[model samples]
Target: MKGRQIILDQINGREAAALMVDGQLDDLLVEGDAPRPGTIYRAVADRPVKGQGGMFLKTPDGNVFLRQVKGLAPGDVMLVQVTGYAEPGKAIPVTQKVLFKSRYVIVTPDAPGINVSRSIHEEDERDRILEVAHEVSREEGVGLILRSACEGADRDEIAEDIANMLDLAEQVLADAEGAAEKLLDGDGPHLAAWRDWSEPAEVVTEAGSFDTHGVLDALEDAQGSRVSLESGVSLFVEPTRALVAVDVNTGGDTSPAAGTKANFAAARALPRALRVRGLGGQVVLDLAPMPKKDRRGFESALRSAFKRDPIDTTLVGWTPLGHFELQRKKARQELREVLK
Candidate 1:
């Protein structure tokens, strides 16, 4: 997290996007007028569609794809959470098995159980949270999922999180009964960054309200079009219609060891670059050719690099043309669209 920073953008005195983070542009922002991913909408189940295998739930904005049809009939109204970040002309998924997320825990109604974050690798810490769950879990049809933020949290704090979420669950249920096409509690990009990434990232902005330095100052050309890493290596980034392509060069090297080292460095840097550029769908990385033995676990390393990204990414294996492949969910509008 050495070069970690969240640089904010301002358009006519309003927040827009992150201009730079570790020498990359942030594509992780939702459009200003769009509905956020965490927004809860009260939807009525419409007539089931035959081919799609899901019913269209009607909200004020448009239809939402609801996967569950069992025990559900036409005109059945209920609460649903927006699982997919919505886009223009695109209907995202929503579910009755809603997950209420907080800084410490995720409370799910309908699916009752207690679990911990998989990212919490330590068994001791996981068990301790589970023990707290046993104490806080009073209802049968509800479940608790301890977040990674709960790692070293005090017992009282965990209990308070549980109590607060339970109250929220009750509120969501009570409000759903008398509501029609209403948005309840929600979260947006700026608030989400404040809530989840405050500790790991330094929030930097060029706005008159805030002070700026570090990553913001180091950036010479915005969007990191010309990136020179501290290790004296450079990356050539090209955004094309089909895919975003990156070329890793150690200032012109042909040796296999040099190729491997550069590829590793590129893998480490690619996530931040991708997040900054908001380049998704498919990505191709060109690295210098190395021995087959040196390629071991490189794909995993690339996937791990993207683990911090808001959207999930997958390694799609290497191509026959010697390029590495990765695909991440396009969570927001493309960086180019926002720049306009």
Candidate 2:
């Protein structure tokens, strides 16, 4: 493999060099010119200072710099990773835009469906929401759901959703300033249910405990079979997000399936397993096989079954080495937390 190197240093600690192989981090070697920029790092150091669209820039002093990237604010926190560039020059930085979007509600008119909505882009509306949230709390008591999840939501619900988030925003500020330890964050059980429903796993919360039923019932009412709770976990499989991966262990305790028919049953259920587990991305299902040709047939059947799920799913068929692969989209982060 081919590689390159970049040096990074800590102000008080020793220096180290990052090794890159094929554009990937391969190793870190000690002893190099990893001098710390020996400078203060500030995200929001300066305000626009009396202009609507003034720009910002980072000026380097000697080999040291105070980075000013377009679209970056003075107070923003940055996670900097050094990447190798072809051109020569020590530590030339190129800015990349990263949008951190939070979930929001979308509202629509004409649908009798409860709580219909479209997701909101943080860039598009967070300021307005924050401002109004303060106002709403001062006058009318309410909360808001920032609405990124409502990308395709209905019309009538949008206003109400905004109102809800605004209400929450004001409370967040008040609790912080008042130093109220008991102040809870503004998330509702309904939103909490959506968080569970957005996961790519078959969510299993303890059966009769924690109002899991209410969560499941509300999700079902709003999203239909896209959400379900059984065996102490609730399962939500949606197509709007990225794919998740699931690993089913035959648990050294249960003996493996005995025959071809049984093996076929397991293979046949791969799609459902993917759906139930919300295993998206490039799924490589390595189950006990039936036979050579049977594997292909089972994959075909599984592919067909995945169509019934509301989420978008595609089976890449079996690998030459025997493993089922699938590609799918799922909600963000929920699946990772659930699986963990």
Candidate 3:
């Protein structure tokens, strides 16, 4: 099939929304997003925190830290990767190590070798994918790690993604400039998806007939309340200023087996919903009560589902209260507000 066509449009006056006209697929929204994670921000080490053991590094956005820059002097400017968002009184966490994200690869400065995702268990396919990845950055510069998304991707797709990443690296190097300040803005949920898709895309200025995507409505809705599923289960996605809590509730008549099925479905949809909504950072998924045997199966289902997520999500295992812990790195504003 030929590459898909993408249309990017401004829905509200200030919000930018994009979609693939290959039948008005999912809408990609990315306006007024902030503190994009996985970016290299050039900042200077500022005054030391008295009892925190780490001094704040000041950037254009604000002061962020990781444990204070070693050998950091007041005037020394350092390159940091934004890890999380900054709350009312809390600074965003940052680190010296930088990871460059692409549609199919993650390039980092820490490792000099090319590493493929473990999901590609087939040894021959893994070698071929790695070879293609190496070809992308071998002569140009650093190595890149293949992401799970590249599992079934063709060489053309992989090559194109790598080229886009290499282009970004070039842009960053050129834009680094003589002075120091955030070197890269990085890609938020929308921009990253748009660029990665790279199919023939168009930007629509007016709604017209693309309303079928439901992305517009999803973006505009801000109730952020509990949503009921057809399986007689309810999902409550609550996002605080710094973290997100998802509570799963089953109906009174729901049987344990049915509840297990609903919870598994919820686990699969949770990350997709969060990514589409642009919700990020620490997340806790409180599933419906289940027996110990079922809990193991439910956790396996979660891990399987998250394997397809483009965002960096870490399943931190089940809590004593049976809540599933997750740490997805995202800093974009919620879709609820983005639509507003």
Candidate 4:
């Protein structure tokens, strides 16, 4: 209960995985209706949008939108991968760049290189991982990226992972000469948990693990709009059609520095809150009434917090109305939508 735990369970017959850290829900993954990111499709190109610089492609599931379409012509066949979840009634977002990602390595086609994770700072460790990568026989022009999980891992296990990924990539790429069809389905929640959550933790696979470990209760709290911070401070995170709106409040605290305190607390708690709730896209924060001089401090705190967050987020700076704006990638399905 005091350490990290990975709880795998089923909710409404859909696979779900929860990351509990020190008795609190840190992250969550729930299977949704859309195709998961990294699913590769051999698609037939459809009509290109006249002004958008993107084209629609016909996949087995449905039509998907691929951006940066420069040379793609109608009826041309190409391989594409799902990039992320699409909005309601929108085409699934996809990219021509497909990657075979595993726990220890990511096989990149069309990009040739062998690179170790920068986090493995020791020269010896880097060289060792590089040596292992070189030993694997892969197709020319295919790249290998050693993930951070390779650090301190068993050499044999790392090599096996790299080899397996490389094999899978080769297989998938070879099958790309066909008509519109799915080449590979993305990893499900259970496999994704094992693949992405590489940190040391106790694994729970029991049927009632979510309820037994209090993950259900934590998820209920995350679904709400209010997140309690330190002391009596709190923040309301409400997602609307256009953007997510966050309102930080000082609550009963009437001290002179209450606004600044609440702002900083909200800054620290915001990333985790959004992550667990699976909220993304444009995020606008309406912080407590702090002075202009404190804006820099709030921005610093927010930037630092998001730096630790795994999702890609751009701090777009403050609005003219004293609100902070952020553009976060829609990496996962929204919790409210997923549960419904």
Candidate 5:
């Protein structure tokens, strides 16, 4: 369990796009931008089309949503920060931005009647905290995330973050106005994800070229764990939705009483293996299902086969098909430590 770095961005919605790690959102990036974010709502006097509000339309990129309607008005600013990555090459998928949805108090007087009516989703509230972050990102009329960094944080800390965000947003506005184009907010989702993962694990790279020191520091600060790196651990990946198969190499733990011994061992190690491998949900262990009769029968033989790691085996009783039923935790991604 090592902390890694990830990136983050505000994409189609207010949510930051990212992949779910341990049921947590990591890696985010903003995908598209309106042609204009703070232009005044000047109604066309002579011949205006119906429903046209002179609003700046952030051009839609691909179907991947990294955009959101923050209801910004002229002079109103939106703040963004560029975060880093969960692991090298583990870029946040722009299409999955919806995974990080949140609701905030939005003030859009120009919209006439649009108010913050929807209640916040539990998942968002549970994951992120609203701190003085609101102030740092204030532009009069905009919505933004009170990132997980603010969760349980002191009021002073929140306020400081908010101020920082506001300052950053103002700078972005200045650049956009002068450029008259879609201004890129140097900070995006990628960096955010990187910072989040830097917690709980150390980020190691094969080559020393991709050094993101600032991202690692920010992640270490946001989270209270040290990130480190390891070497010589080879990772193999196999993409399969089929049932996961774990084979234990006991190198001949088998003896005259090996059947019962192996079964007991597998029952003990099985759980740990499942957790380490990040396997879960409905798992078909394919172990020997029947009773062993003094640990030397067919049951004993089956147990010996998987006993090396047996803690994970929860004999969910037996199944109608005479097959043994067991459940393992589901992992969001390929388990990097299954073999180890």
Candidate 6:
């Protein structure tokens, strides 16, 4: 309970994985019905929306909408990858850029280069990983990216991962001429946990691990709109049809710095709240009443907090009415929707 622990369990007979750190739930992944991001497909081009500059494509799953529709024509066949979950009653979001990602390596079919993650800065380690990449017999245009997890990894494991990804990329790229069909299925919760959570942790795969590890309780708390920060400060994170609205409350604190303290706490806790709820898209924060001079500090705090988060989020700055805004990617389905 002191260190990181991964609990693999079933919620409502659906596959789910929970990451717990120091007896608290840090992250959660639950299976959903939408096509998972990173799935590859050989799709046939459908009609284009003239003003929107987007094109619809016919896939085995259904019709998907692709952006940046330059140099694509109707009836043309091409390969695409699912980018993220689509809104309700909307086409699945996709992109022409496809990538084969794994724990230690990512295969880039379009970009051509061998690069190591910047986190591994030692020259000797970088050189060793580069040599391992060079040993793989990849095609001319396909590129290789050595992830940060490759640092200090076994040579054989790195080489094997690279080789496996190259083979899979070659196979998928070769089958681009077929009808609209799925070329590859994305990784499920268990596999995704293995791929992304590379750090050493205790693994629990027994039945009812969620209850045993307190993940169920954490999830139950995440389902509510109120999140308690520190010193009786709390915030309400509610999702509306258009955006997520966060209202901060200072509670019973009546000190001169109460508003500032509450706002800063909200800034630090907002990312985790949104992440656990799997809420994304536009977000508006109605922070506690604070002086204008403290706005810079609040912005800095928010930016630093989001920088450590895994999901892609953009701090879109403050509005005219003193509301802070953010734009987050739809990386996961809404927790309420998934549960229902």
Instruction: Pick the TM-score winner.
Output: 4
Which 10-residue span in candidate 6 carries the lowest summed lDDT?
A: 136-145
Worst 10 residues of 3 by lDDT: 1-10
Off by over 4 Å in 1: 1-12, 15-31, 45-56, 66-78, 86-89, 93-97, 118-128, 175-180, 198-211, 214-227, 230-232, 236-243, 308-310
Candidate 1 Cα deviation (angstroms), residue 253: 2.2
CA RMSD per model (angstroms): 4.3, 19.0, 4.9, 1.1, 15.5, 1.3
Candidate 3 colliding pairs: 5-200, 6-200, 6-201, 6-202, 7-202, 8-202, 8-203, 42-182
Winner on TM-score between 2 and 4 is 4
Give one digit per residue, the lDDT tens place, for model 5 in 11-102: 22432323323322232223333211122211111221235332222222111112233343443323221121112132211210111122
Q: Is candidate 1 or candidate 3 better by lDDT?
A: 1
Give lDDT for model 6: 0.92
Model 3, 69-159: lDDT tens per residue?
A: 4577776766778876655467878877677787688766546677888867999889889878767775334667787678777998898
RMSD (CA, Å), candidate 6 to true, equals 1.3
Report how far residue 205 has shifted in candidate 6, in Å.
1.0
Ranking by TM-score: 4, 6, 1, 3, 2, 5
Q: Candidates' lDDT values, in order?
A: 0.69, 0.35, 0.68, 0.92, 0.33, 0.92
- Candidate 6 lDDT, tens digit per residue, 162-214? 99999999999999997899999988888888888888899999999899889
| Alpha-carbon shift of residue 95 in model 2 (angstroms) | 22
Which 10 successive residues of model 5 have the least lDDT summed? 92-101
Q: Show the colliding residue pairs in model 4.
A: none
